[model samples]
Target: MTDVQELSDWAPDWLQAITPQNRAGLQVPDQVEDSRLQTPLSQLSQSNHDRDDELKPPKITNITVMPSPNRMVKRKLQGIHLFMITVNGTLGIGLYWRGGQILELAGPLAALLAFLLVGLLSWAVMQCITEMLCIWPIPGALSVYVSEFVDVELGIAVGIAYWFSYSVGFGALIATLAAEFDFWTGTSGDKGIDGGIVYLLIPVILIAVNALDIEIYGLLEVVTGCLKVACLLAIGGVLIAVNVGAGKQGYIGTQYWASPKVYDRDAANDWGTAFLMCLSVAIYAYMGVEIVAASALESAPSARWTRKTSDERESQLAQTPNDSLIGNTVRFSAKYISLLATISYSLSGLLVSFDIPWYHCHLPRLSWVDSTANIDCSDVSDSIPANTTSAIVAIAVESGIPHLADVVNVFLVFTCLSCASTNLYVASRVLFGLTSRLDGGKGQPWHLRLLSWFGRTNRYRVPLRAMIFSAASFIWVPFLQLQGGTSSSTSIGMFIEILAQMSSVAVVIVWTCQVLAFIRYYHCIKRHKNVLEQQKIPQLSRDNVEDYSYRSHAQPVLAYVALAGCLFVLVVANGAYLWKGFHKFPFLSSYLFIVVFVAMWILLKVARGARWRHVDLSNPDKVVRKLRKLHDIRLAAS
Candidate 1:
């Protein structure tokens, strides 16, 4: 008899019933099964019977008893770690440099408005993510949700694009670090140590940190995240002090905003166009905020629930309060971090606008511009060394606080390092998620079979291969400095801008997919409400149906709003090329990801002959039934 037939003969009914075709009914979608699917009871029974003849347990038997390879990412992150990472992931070098870029692109008020608008979109995206996370709480939750609820092709596309975005962002961080180091050491092109050397070292350090236990990474993020918050606060205080005549230029209140030249008339003719153009920059600033959801795979509760036997999991659930679940923590963290990010970004824009004239930073300065009331355009020189100093540092210098500029530069280095590490961590996990599957299973498409190599983990339970690959991919970004040119600073600035724009586009696309996925999930839940109610799932029970604990407020309305916002930003922010007459480089950088995304979707569709699985109303209860089983198990265990 075939092995499958033989196994089925002695397998328990539960084991016999489990198959890929019907896994959706069991509430275990193929993607979730990729991580937590246990070995069939029959396999264990057969292994034990066969091993009885051996004097000791065979090595293979021990391997069989271990958790699946995909579940190996250690869950060491606690509630505090999640909260801090959520905050820190989005808080990075962008905050340091992006303010000046946006203020230069759009005037102060337009920049402030853009930050607020994107913040609302971020809120909606996080709400959708948190709600879905409460239900699945799986590793690589973002792409997995897209794949499960939406379609596999789109999920693959989003996963790859998101991973690419982080990878590219990591490169951008490295470039920023080199720029900061140049500023700190008073070095530039054809000068002191090569920036490329610094680039090489940063990634090595980040890889080492990520390679350690996840808890250590979490702790590091918490510390750096706190430092980042403190840095922002200090900068804010300094800005306020400078605005009130503490600096060389006294009583600088609203001087810049009141100037007719405050807005960049060259960039955009109208305030509205300027606002639209800067949306991508604002979105880039908020890119990493949703990483908390990505890190949910390693969360303590999620880990505990996934690793336990059904009975053990049930017992634990019986004792644990529902509110204490990872879902609640994720929801709280999302809300807290989004609010914090918005306020911080808006205030930074507003404060910077007060101290420095938008016209002052209109042209990128290679070296610090000194504060002088009578400074003329003729005094501007192109010979200053290129530095990665923020507009805030320029403000400090212009305020006669040169020492404060140095301190801010130091903090900027740390911020870049912290953010680079987070990017690597997220990218590796996303790549790992993309390649995860059952051992020896043919579930993944042939094109992706080679990537399965990165799916494995070492004894530390980290996806070491994937981590190494991700770090290595961005190593070339810093080498751009090696290219000899008179306008090296301008080159670096343009490179960073291109990366930011492309990454921002990728972020919006991912957000759009996520919001759409949530919409589908929302509808699926509604269609299956009766099944869910009958199953007595607390979150969806008859009494609690309308007031689901983890449900995001405003339901479908907020989701649609988020969707519309993402689409608007994706099209409008990148469409500047269309109006300005397409420059080859800008046009490519702006919409290249979209072209890549569409191409990928088509390739996968053609390769796999897959079709978009429209809302499967017929099996609407599949997800609901799965939730019911999970709830029932938890109750029984309790």
Candidate 2:
């Protein structure tokens, strides 16, 4: 503080002595390169500096108070709960109607094969997501993963594709409920419930259920999940019992193949039409398999309080209020459970298919009080139009135990309601995630708006704006069926099935991304290992990095296999539609899946002002940041 303080005190004179008076007097350090040092700040002019300063964030005013702690919003969910909610969502649409259609398209043998193969692929997608959840438990689950692993543009593309595909569920369910309401009330012909009570009720009911605290929703899901599991089991058990009791007469394996003449072996029943119908059926059967990802948001909130002991990071992940242990367990359990639901639904379809003469004139709707109960299904001669799954229950009830059929119908209605609830939740959350301005602390623009509308201290946080958006988004589906004429009996059903199948295809793509992420993670670990080995350092204490590394490496292979399987299903299921007499069929809906996917991606890219140059990974500026992060060994992106 002696000499230095004296110099500092007399800085007015000392600065003049040390400072350069002009360009000629300036003396820069030798270490500074000409490219950098030659660029004098004063010489550059004020406009350049002004521009640079403008690019930076504005400083916060001293008068502004720090933001309040994110209002202690709901925390992250556990792995299990996340898993279960996902399973319930995924299995919802697929089990209800797709199986019977698959049986008709691929034959019993082929349909079963399709289910197993697709299920494997679906599982792969689920596992990849599982690994992702472990690594990054955020609300924008897939979108976040894709952004980090692939380029941000690609991530945004995938997110948009996924969101659009998911929106179909909300739309499809409204249509489905309308169809059900029409059937029960006998107004499906024309001026039916399509534009009536069901459409309005769907949104209102969905909002009511979703607006509750997440824990209440979880409890409801658990109860519904259990019932869904029981329903599938009961359906399977009853079918098996009946088939066994029917003995040889109950089994008609190649009936469709043998009776081509009766069902029409003509131009109308050619491979193309048959294939289109088959694909239409198959698509509908497996539509809702991606619902798992949708459930991730709510699951975290439900298991918010549960605690677990693990890696500090993992424990941190677990205790994140929304990312609790219970949620994780539910998510994982749901994946396997979805497979069970698929198999049960498939078996029930198989049992019913034996009774229907696929190649002949429509099979009798079971004999008892019967002849008048006969549905004039001439318009829908290709497939069972009015509630296909319910049709099977009708046949069984008409033929065997009528009482049990009545009981099953209640459960069937329960399944539809559960599905609608799940879809609404998904729709709202998707809207929330997509519209949310995440750069604004933990809260979004919509979140604050919700807080204002719902009250600040409310435990139940509902994005009312998003819910309204979802409600509006689905309004057209029910009414759209009115334009189809008499053929419209199956038109709404067909539209729903078509869209649902496309969503499944989109899920396959998302699943593929998960696998790719797994592969990248594996390579990252491998690179890290090789670097450690080359250094040849002394023995050091280690974390379970290797275990995680091993898991990351192993899981992707399964994911790849699943990806291949999904592609094969899309090909086989839709192959007949595309390859055989392409124009003769309703290829628009089938093609619409890919069309929407690409169009949405392009629109998102355009909206973001992203171009090929922006996505270019070769740009040095873009890569240098990553290289610096790797070499400098800084904290990871939280």
Candidate 3:
């Protein structure tokens, strides 16, 4: 027997945590009490969690995941809400928190341009993801495609890289909350006492929100997304207005940019090093974009659950799952994944460059408690270099807005909260999608069966159990981070590399993995076309190349450029860390990025056997073909 079956008690009751209790009967239609599915709510209210355990589904030891298809009348979240997913994912704390760092790395002008460059590159990368997703629309976008179209072992590595990246990111998010409070009060609160409270609340809130139904998640994101966009717009407008002599500090236009050192390098020789480090910092600021592709399965209809196959029902599944909501969601997913973040980030960068000087910063100190004093940047020698947090504070102070900096700090706090929630949301879903396919259709091993326990979703279809399991990292890792709480030696801060220069490595790795997967996907398509032409075979009656939804505008060109750009960023992102000498960083900090990435890949390879499992190029996945058939009849009739 394989190791999975031999250890029956390994993480027992893990899958059972879905909606209190889960079992065989949970798969039965009548047993599933999806309150949102049965009828539309007249007045939307928060999902009540108290009654989730009332239904007693019969227990079974074995794991069996069924396809969940939506019938015509049952769903929340029109395409409009699809934008919420991507917006929430991309508009993270990085843009608001890193202004100070950007100013310090390079002058505001170069940093602004660098940030804009990263946005463009990020959009390019998302385009590649969009091309794959529009074709597949499967859960766990990159990993699923890589596993199905590329190789199983390689796919697993990519998926873990993604999972681990986001897992560490949760700590990064928590670390920021303390900083947010510090900025808000203009004084660092008692680290041990107050930090303890946030550590307790952050995970509980995320779990509570994510554990509920999809509608609740969608609603929360929509509201939060709107507020975040508003905040960005208001701040951007204020910054622009102030630059034109509208503030206490008069007529600042481009003066900061033309100041003594537009760039941070001392010598021409070190210019190369400074530029690359700045570029990496800019790129790392745009992490958390994968939520769009990661949540694609949930945001759009994959039709895993459907009525029994019959002439009518089968025909229904084949014709593009005709609903305006799904149509709009699909369309919006493509547009919004990069649009909101790109515009906001670019504008924000320009504003920061205009308002803040490279050297002096008025950002709150770590132990500051004064609310009624002028911030003197000239005297402070050990001030935290201007990052996004300090940038906002500096801009507000310059604008002559009373307590505006504190208000913006509060907004930044919400930004972190929303980001960590999104991370937990996607992390849980990725783990669920992987374990759900443990008993793979055409490719898988015996040991995979053991992990199937992490695969199930709750009755509300929220991946509740999987989400809770993923939240285990929050219990200790973030708690340690809170202990340090903006002090000199923050907990888990070293591990995540947010304080260090390790931030962009994870983003680069994820982008490269997906682009590599895209290359394989491209090969599969051509290989299929070649086989069809040689065999003189007719296209399947319900199949249409056009039916798979949106085709990426540029085929391999977009993907290739994206891959090259990401690889370049990866090599250069760590230049700052390297300057201190590679030997200085042990295992815990930013340097662990490469080590963790390679080690995880090797470990997965050994577990899968000596060699990787290469997907058969001659035959693409059945699900891919099935999805293409969707809208086929619609296209035929048109």
Candidate 4:
């Protein structure tokens, strides 16, 4: 065997946490933390990944041996699949009820404006994440990127916060289902299927669908996305036809805009409340846009689908599907999804402000959340609460065509079902990937080892246990909402708000960290570049200044701008409730989500203890280990 000094000499720069001066007695840990997902939480302490040989794949438990080869996740996703995934991922709440919030807070014009501006800023945020994904090409991307580019603890913090957000967001979506169920009972000849039955059925169906096969999951997204695209087109066409006297409204275009007010005209706070609050609601609408990054590592490119040819061979030589091809596909997926978001939200802005009357413009049940707002459109038709189901039903009732509303309500159910399934899928993978990072072979703590089991994939290559655990986490919230009844919506209203509040906080923080992580990533690369130049050593034969495949050009600047813009919106978005004094709760309620996120982060730190203190980059004794594979990609691509 070679001496330790010889081993140290051959280590990749990114993998070198020990310097030559102290190489004599140094004992490097033999745990490779490099993979698409990087290392687990336990592996982060000795943040330097062990060599590849040290990272032999963990033996799969043959407790229940299966016929097929065991893999954590089947890499079956393709371009169209990823494109559909992005579409479903980004356009969740926006498709159903978010239009009403925008229309209510900022009116039609401002709502449309809110979507465009926010979408642009959000896209900027995506650019940062895309850059990271291009370089890293890893699973559990957000946490892995944050750990390597920023701080490992911060990565764990982001993972936890994101998990909480997705969990609560799932509940928020489920809570609204009750309002949609109202449409059927009120209009469908009293089928006798109450909201409770719908609630119970949704989770079971989703779990079965998610656990069966990933191909089914991809197929589900494609079918649902096509239907959603069709629905959006139909809704837009309806808006156009009705405005042009196809309906009795007779050239109704912009008439409602003029009457109910073009903007909310919250003239008090310099009209900022109208725009800012709408921006806040708009944030939720576009919340899932960045999901492309989360799933990119698993997204299979066109090369995976087709048989190779002579022409394609040259392209393959230049780029493999894993890096450039996959990166391009991911970028394309994000683009199409963002484009869809912009079109849908803008069209909805026009359609909702015109169709759903000003008075009926309450929260859009989310397409049924706050039933108190549905008082007008209730079974008795006494109070009309502001929601998509209620507003459309109210319009249909006014037009003496109640059946149409039933169809729309049914359609909204499908929409929410698709969105909820996606959320559950995201939640399970993120939580599983987070826990997987802590896997420390057989020598780890009992608790750590026990939790690691939850991350294991079953026969279908699905994190079956993690999926069930995630399903169970927020499953109870909606049940409570069902029990609260729509009479006053007393319990449901507060509960949804709390969930939304927490979700808003956690998601925003996670997003902000992504932007900040990019900045740190740029600095890390620049530092490495400077050191290589100073030492008169070429890092790679083909490494020029433009070596990075997808550099975040003018990086820290764009990152800073995106970061500031998102943060400002986050502050105003949550606190807008208390801004006008026409609010329901206290300042504490608005900021409660942030408090919860910090609490979760601190608890995680306490759980981790002080083993990782040396990982603090600023410390003099800190051991630095950059991602080695990331360097290989830059060299190969360049």
Per-prediction TM-score to the true structure, in the order listed:
0.80, 0.68, 0.75, 0.77
Q: How many angstroms is residue 470 displaced in model 2 relative to the true structure, after the best TM-score fit?
A: 2.1
Give the alpha carbon lDDT tens digit for every residue of 152-205 in model 1: 788888998899898888887777677677665655443334443566766887
Q: Candidate 3's C-alpha lDDT?
A: 0.57
Model 3, 1-638: lDDT tens digits are: 10111111211222223221333432212211211011112211225564354344523233222233210112455455667766766788778756556666556665566677787778778777776665444555577667656676767777766766666666667766765666533344555544556666767877898887787778888898888788878878777776776444445557766653444443112545655666776765677665666665565453322456677656656654333124335555664566667777777877777766665544322121121232446544343324334577666665666677667777778787887888787777777656664543235455665566566666676667677877776446555644444543233444434433444576677788788777876765565664333222223211354344445557678788888888777765544536534434322244567777778777887865757456656543342332233222111111
Model 2, residue 554: what's the lDDT? 49
Report per-prediction Cα RMSD to one decimal.
9.1, 12.8, 12.7, 8.8
Q: What TM-score does candidate 1 reach?
A: 0.80
Give the alpha-carbon lDDT of every model: 0.67, 0.48, 0.57, 0.60
In model 4, how large is the Cα lDDT of residue 387? 34
Q: Rank the candidates by TM-score, best first.
A: 1, 4, 3, 2
Which runs in model 2 stand beyond 4 Å of their true positions? 1-73, 76-84, 187-195, 248-290, 298-331, 334-338, 353-391, 437-459, 482-498, 528-556, 566-575, 606-638
Best-first order by lDDT? 1, 4, 3, 2
Give candidate 3 misplaced runs (Cα > 4 Å).
1-76, 184-188, 191-193, 246-251, 259-261, 265-269, 301-318, 321-328, 362-376, 379-389, 440-450, 481-483, 488-504, 530-545, 579-591, 610-638
- Candidate topping TM-score: 1
RMSD of 4: 8.8
Worst 10 residues of 2 by lDDT: 1-10
